[model samples]
Target chain A: MTTSSTLRPGVGDRSVTDPGPPAPRPRGDGAAALAFLTPSIITFLVFVLAPTVGVLVLSFYNWNLLSDGTFVGLDNFDRLIHDGRLLGVYGSTTYMALAILAVNVVLGLLLAVLLETRMPRWLRGFFRLSYLFPFVVSASAVALIWRFLLNKDLGLVNYLLGLVHVDRIDWLGSSAFAPVSVIIVNSWKTIGFSILVYIAGLQSIPDQLREAAIVDGAGAWTRFWRITFPLLSPTIFFLVVINTINSFQIFAEPRVLTQGGPGDSSRTIVEYLYDRAFGDFDLGYASAIGITFALILVVLTAIQFWFSRRWTFY
Target chain B: MSTATTSMSPRLGRLAARVLTFLVLGIAALAITAPFLWIFRGALSGSDAELYRLPPTFDAGTLTVRNFGRVTEQVPYFRFFLNSIIVSTVVTAAQLITCSTAAYAFARLRFRGKGVLFALVIGSLMIPIQVTIVPLFLVMSKLGLTNTLWALILPGIFSAFGIFLLRQHFLGLPRGLEEAAKIDGAGQFRTFARIILPLSGPSIATLGILCFTYWWNDLLLPLVMISDTDRQTLPVGLVLLAGRFSTGSLGTIAAGITMAIVPVLVVFLAAQRYIVQSIASSGLKL
Candidate 1:
């Protein structure tokens, strides 16, 4: 009966009644498919595939804008291991990315869970919009606005600090505060996105389950631990993976805010790579860094995917 | 009696939950709004307003249009705005056409090498643009496309994410509808135009909003691609203004920042539902 119902549309009465008939191929299906896929294929090849292959090839040879190529086999990779500034840059980038991810996920989840409760509809919407406002603004604008707010002598942050009798600190100029400032700004910009994702995940959970838990006398904390928290793992897992990838690639904020330092304090890997290629005109080394960064990202993402299998409910 | 006792605790718990929820939301709201208020205050302050001075004041009487005037005169503000609008609009339009057609093929068609080709498309997502910058720049320079808006617009149009997103949306659609149209003697092209295109409004809006916002606010591409001052996008343009005003006073820079973000913010406000929905459904899977 099930087979008959499933076959009714495609095969009609004859095929449904007779258990052994060959399936018919639609006419022009191949031609039609190729015609539709042509644009995407061409675009993928030109922009993504070609450029990727180019980067891999460029990594093996020493070719700047002016000079002809010299195949310097593993030398670039070798230098990457020992370069002092490059090492510092990697440390700063990883530290900053992880910091931002931690803050954003924790705060975002908290906010999402809060907003999902009995808040007024209009109020919830307003808060969501406000949270996401920083994201919608351009990165340069965010940098400039925050710079104004954080100015040591003349900025509002210090002024506010004065009211509380706190000594003014150079938020952007100090090495210690500069990375923190970047992380704060990035978190402010990105937490909204994480919050929105969490809300969606939160909404997907059936209220009946919570109600049942309550009827069985499960307290708020208990209900959350046993029910809500586990359900939210998938969303959390997704955010962590994407956020980590994005963090490793951080550039604009540090560039605009501190130019990567009160020294080399805030130099991220991408900034380091940029300097090597454009600042010093060392393409081979830059390509090597790029390759390394890509490999790290792949490995990290794979681990996340593996861990997700255990924790991600879906 | 026991049932009554149990109900009493649950009711109180509900009340507590409500109150706690409000408190958390209020704090989140403040965190989000604080920066915006700071920006607003900075933009409106007079030139002489001392930085780091306690009790920040924005006396409406002291506010002036001086910063706006300075932003316009000192930099090519209008030109940057024009460049951003033109680049973003062109990229969005081109992506719409390219992504939709491609998505349709992936969803409905069965061609040779389709599996391998589709894998390539999805795999490209893992390759960040940073890795490809050198080669892309080299190619652009060779083509004499550097410093031109085409450099930004062309690359922005062909996104793997866009293709993947539209394909997901297309796959969710009922195949029976398209099949019925096909049975009516409609050719592939005809069915696509008369059937598929019209049904794709929601997905298109999602892609359009995402693409527009991305290109509208992009910084890295413009920074590297365009060296000429007039060719800079809004982000680059604002950075230049910031550099010009980075000397003690920030009034002009604050005003420039405000102006730069307002249009995109307004678009975000209007289309927020679509934005939120798209972001949610896409699952930040990228």
Candidate 2:
């Protein structure tokens, strides 16, 4: 389809082909284009861009929700540097995010490879859909369902554990297991997406390449590592960037399940930001933390993009 | 190099590979399915006894709709449901109108600053919503939209990701149909409305479904914006219900969760094909 479109002639193509219409002039396109774009630009600028800039400006002030602004440049950043709990929040969020990313990428790749092999087509579709169902459900719903399944006394998980004579673990209550549980639930909800991406990547690899590897007496493991893995790197790179960003922004799951509970065991940075701004009524400080978090994300994303060019095939 | 050895080894390897693949995939399927089964059984369980019983029994007599009734009675289930519907619908409709127009411009029109503007829109995708929340709330408060449905619906109406997705779809559309309409003396808006919009039904449906689901299941924005109980969306309302009914039977809370989840699940099942395609395509883009 793309090939056919590129071959066709149109006003757009003519402009590029002949250079007859000057690029700078409106050429009656400006009004029509502006008419088409105005609503989105207005809403985006007002709702998204304005608030984004406002938050950055708000971060440098000491204005609480009640009082007028007093300049407190760098105080919030200084306080953040000294705050031990903030460090814990950063540690917990990073650890959980990375752990979940590793698990999901490995598991998703495994599933994709298996399903794309000589498996029954129907079974492949069924597994794909079943895995994706949890993802399609709301985060709140997923947390609620899991909370029921993992309840200490009346939960089904503990009940099953009893049958195996294993002790019931406080999945959400214990500091040791709460983050682990969040990671597990998050991976479960999200692994399907990574799997699909891997599937797409797997499908794009030409069949002749795999056949040649097989004809050369390469075993499945060797073929996967030597041939498929390299081809799958672009998908892996995409998943890593998206998953990292999402992990840092984790909010709904912990909010529903733990409330950063049992002594702030699952207090992620975003949740801490929420607590400060809303719970503690420290809007100025929260804005400062949020701005700092955003900057960190931007830098991380920039680094990812820079590094991706080296490793990501496409 | 021996023919007999090569033939026999190939046969044996094929059988072993088949068996191993089945074993691995079966275990993965089981692991993926366990939580779903657990949730369903708990939802169907009659008493808390069945919920905690060893081996997790699913007795026929214990399964009933009593909990479903309790869910409605314990919370303002209908009100929250209506709130979710209204917000999701408004947001989806507004997004379709605003995003399609912007997407059309990016896809079809030649204008000054097009490259810069398009880049700005795409760059917004990397900006986390958390960064914008503080001042967004301030804006909402100043507009007197706090504690109202507008706070939830308005902000979501112009998502950058939505515009990007639609623009990609529109750019791939055939130009012949639109050219035919233009030759008939149709203006750009008419050409879009008559030709491009109809041809883009599948993409439109995908966008609508995604936007609806996101708003329907959203918890964070509603949590921050809404202070009034009556205006709370379903997720927020359910959380409040769980807190209030903390001392009550677990059945009611489970039922409320189920109630909140079922309608969306039904919608998804009905639109499973389009929804799945959207996820697959969008997954690749990400």
Q: Write down the DockQ of candidate 2.
A: 0.40
- Poorly placed runs, candidate 2 (over 4 Å): A1-28, A159-166, B1-13, B174-184
lDDT of each: 0.78, 0.79
lDDT of predicted model 2: 0.79
In Å, residue A99's CA in model 2 sits off its true spot by: 1.5
Estimate, for each residue in A126-181, the C-alpha lDDT of model 2 and write its tens digit: 77777677777778878877777777776667777888898989988999888887
Measured by TM-score, the strongest candidate is: 1
- Per-residue lDDT tens digits of candidate 2, residues B78-115? 99999999999999998988888888889998889999
Model 1: per-residue lDDT, tens digit, A168-211?
98889999989888898888888888888888888888999999
Let me know the TM-score candidate 2 reaches against the reference structure.
Answer: 0.89
lDDT of 1 by residue, B224-258 (tens): 78999999889899888878854755777777887
- How much does each candidate deviate from the true structure in C-alpha RMSD? 6.9, 5.9
